[model samples]
Target: MSAAWVLGKRALREGRRTPDALLPTLFIPLFFLVVNVGQAAKIFPAASTEFLHGQGYGAFQLPSSLLLAASFGTAALFLVEEIEGGYFDKLRASPVPRSAIVLGRLIAELVKAVAITTVLVLLGLAFGISIASGPVGFVLLVALTALWAVVFVGFMQIIALKTRSAAATNSAGLVFFPLLFLTPNFVPRDLLTRPMEIAATLNPVTYVMEALRSLILEDLEWGTIAPGFAVVLALGAVMLALNVRVIQRYD
Candidate 1:
């Protein structure tokens, strides 16, 4: 555990110090936030706009950026480079536990994910977005976002371990995020078309979005918040276990 902390700190530092790590993750969601809101506001109904007055369209779609951007950790990308350079083998030869290797990278990604989310949240606030749940909801927002990011870290690392290929690791999110975009990304689930509404109802990302939307756009209700964390927690555990096993069984 001590070694894991040490590695975790080092991993975190590496992530922080690298500008590239922040750029790609930060750019996408932020870009989407601005673009989506800019276009949607022009065409959206006044009642809908009035309904989301505090954060407006930006606040409502804020999770689109928050959840999507923070969710993709470059841990796998780093692992790929390390594996190619033989540093991964050196770590394997070291006394650090296998779980530490995986968890350490995960910790680093979590830190990065949270940092990115915080910056974006602050940026949203700068544009007049308010936190619906106040201080407490802000904390929950960060934690829940980090939990979701952790799940992604596990999935990405599994790709890193099994394929050990930069190409494969980088493409992991490509396979998973379409469903996220298809969810109530542009509007509330209730506002979605019938087929899309049904899809959003079934999508876990919808719960994650509504959970976050509650903090920024709606009243914070356990009814909304709890389910998001519950789903992420349940899913995060499975991803964590699978990544741990992959690491433990690695040759």
Candidate 2:
């Protein structure tokens, strides 16, 4: 645990030193949020959009942006750099537990997620969006979003460990784009066409978006929010296991 903590701190420090790498993670999401809201706000004004539950279209779209922000993690890229620099080999030869190496990067991702979620939420509020679940829900929203980020970074780390290539790890991040778009980003799942609705239903990212939308557009509805947490936990478990296995077998 201590080793994981130390490594997590080191990762955080490294992130601090490379703000340029961090900007795109925040910027792209913000750009999507602004563009989506601008394009659709008129069509789905809060005054008439039942799905929005009296909130602006920005509220409905905020979760998509949050999820996008969480998906743009740099941990795997950093891992590739460590591998190429031989630092990863040094850690492997040391007394650090293999799991610590993975958890350390995830811990840093969780921290970054919290910061990114907070910034985006604040910006959402600035755009006249409000959280119906209030402050407690706000906290839960950030926690869940950050957990999803960690889960994604775990998958990316698996790629990093297996290929040990910066290019492959970066390319792997693009896979999340289709996952994001396949969800009901611009409309309610019920409102989507039959085929797209089924597609969105199968997409796990849909649950995360609905869960976050519930927090922003409605009161504390655990029935709606629990599934998002469940998905995150399940994905985190699988990703972490795979990451550790890859590291254990890494040459």
Candidate 3:
């Protein structure tokens, strides 16, 4: 078998065997979706503001939950599993191209992201959350989610390759929240605190949130979506380079 196939199968098997690995990807987003959407109206009185650039709280916060499921949650689990299983070491020693190992993990992360998004989309539909930009915008939303999964997972893999400890992986996962919360996630960008405004200005997650907001809220603004997608690709490349170096240095 090809090395990519071997590594891919390994990832698939590990994912299936550990319910914990996949369960959070399914439930955490759903839980947050329900809780946040329920409270957004009550909490963010300005959600009704047309100047905010999003429809309402539910649609506004949906991308954050989706991105969390795609990156922070599932990426942590995958890293922890690889560390616990000593699969990273095994892959390092194998004759397979290093890219195969990385690609396999990226593929696995994408699958997990898709599953999470699919479930959330169904829930959103049930709650009457339709795409504002028509069918193309809806497709872009899914594409962006998957793309973000690839880039974010690559970034996490770089951390995982260096740390090689579940505890450290967990710590690294927590690092995402500051970036996530500092953005215009629940509240609109116009209502952000000064510190939050600065943080959101620097955060790549903000770009993604903005892009998703544009699509789902029927606000077809390429100015918002393009930068987010571009940054995702740019960051992915840097992370992939770091991952390659870490793997090469693996003892």
What TM-score does structure 3 among the candidates reach? Answer: 0.88
The residue-by-residue lDDT of candidate 1 on 1-251, one tens digit each, is 88777888988887878887769888888888889988987666545565574456777888878888866767778888888899888888998787888888888777877787888888988997889889888988888888888887788888889998989888886855776867888777778899999888888878888898888866678899999999899988898899879888988
Clashing pairs in 2: none
lDDT tens per residue, model 2, 178-236? 99888998998988999999999999989998999999999999998999999999999
Stretch of 10 with least lDDT, candidate 3: 45-54
Clashing pairs in 1: none
Task: Give the clash count for model 3.
Answer: 0
Question: On a 0 to 100 scale, what is the lDDT of residue 94 in model 3?
Answer: 74
lDDT of each: 0.82, 0.92, 0.74
Model 3 CA deviation exceeding 4 Å by range:
43-48, 51-55, 73-80
- Give model 2's TM-score versus the native structure: 0.98
- What order do candidates take by lDDT, descending? 2, 1, 3
Candidate 3 lDDT by residue in tens digits, 103-188: 77777667766666777866886786777877888778887887888887777777777777767776777777777888887776
RMSD in angstroms, candidate 1?
A: 1.7
TM-score of each predicted structure versus truth: 0.94, 0.98, 0.88
Native-structure RMSD, model 3: 2.6
